[model samples]
Target: MTNHTPPIIGLAGGIGSGKSTITKCFNNLGVQSVDADDVARLVVQPNSDCLNKIYQRYGEDILMNDGSLDRRSLRTIIFNRPEERTWLEALTHPAIKEEITSQLSKLTSKYALLVHPLLFETHQNAICQLVVAIDVPKEIQIQRVISRDNTDQESVEKIISTQLSNSERIHRANLILENTGNIDEMNAKVFKLHQNILELISC
Candidate 1:
């Protein structure tokens, strides 16, 4: 990979808004992506300092039999208590940001896709030359999360409620990609947007 630090294009979306699918489409076009969610997972892996800190705070109950973080259980706790969520974010955000920067630095693409649900929330948009927000209907987001995670509608709603509203995200984004259609339609939209981003960045 090139050591060149390319311009970043941040991707933002609510839970289950198909950001991953869109990232995959960008990857197919040879654009490397650095996913904050994936980095978040990495920073808290079993035996990591972040995980050890979490275990100290929340106890072994938050750990699986194999010693990995029990994410679903932890999610329930944090979502129910805003204070706990704040504490967790305080503990993990810096580590995740560091990892994301390290990964983006190694990408060979002309521009790097930074896929982060909290791109704007965490002020990560500051690092991006442009930001794209995926806009999906709230109902569709709930349905997709329920189907994909085998989660309940209420839980999905709670997650969505914590995120920026669709209109707010659209207002903040440099561009918006609507994703309420079929897979083929989404792919087409992603391809077109990919070209547009390339053109914009080249100028």
Candidate 2:
């Protein structure tokens, strides 16, 4: 758990709180990032063992004609049913964790960013040396999600309901980055945070 080993920085934020923006900013500063969403998708690709487990649990209907897991269909199922979501998480989380750990082990940067929307829910924050939550109002989250995802307000709210609230994340995180301001303000916060993180790791 020494900082000399390239600390894992968990970027935890709500559905539309701009975690991706922070991740991109870190990337611009030459920091390595591993996104849990990307790892989740990768583990379920056409021929993966995780996909086999999913098919075994949900049956052939969850698969496409091309033998790939129909992610949209599965997402609909799990999000609507807590039992199903739990079952799916149990099957996939372990694999995702393994892959993320492996990827982090290979990072050469001063720190590696683990971008996860469900960082706290999945308990992925346990692996991070520091956790930073991006903050925004619930209204802003809903509006931004609707605009960015082309989804309805109700749908965005439903997704938000499933995640830990902004306040909870802010309380739990080591630092908080408020995103209510403009992009320039957000960039400044990211830059300052980057310097602060570098100093922390160096110490």
User: What RMSD value applies to candidate 1?
Assistant: 1.5
- Tell me which residue pairs clash in candidate 1: none
Pairs in steric clash, model 2: none
List, residue by residue over 13-117, the lDDT tens digit for candidate 1.
989999888898899989999999999999999899999999999998999999999999999999999999999999999999989988999888889999998
Candidate 2 Cα errors over 4 Å, as ranges: 1-4
lDDT of each: 0.93, 0.88
Top candidate (TM-score): 1
Tell me how far the alpha carbon of residue 152 in candidate 1 is from the true structure, in angstroms, after superposition: 0.9
Model 2: lowest-lDDT 10 consecutive positions: 1-10
Reference-based lDDT, residue 39, model 1: 96
All candidates' TM-scores?
Answer: 0.97, 0.91
At residue 66, candidate 1 shows an lDDT of 98
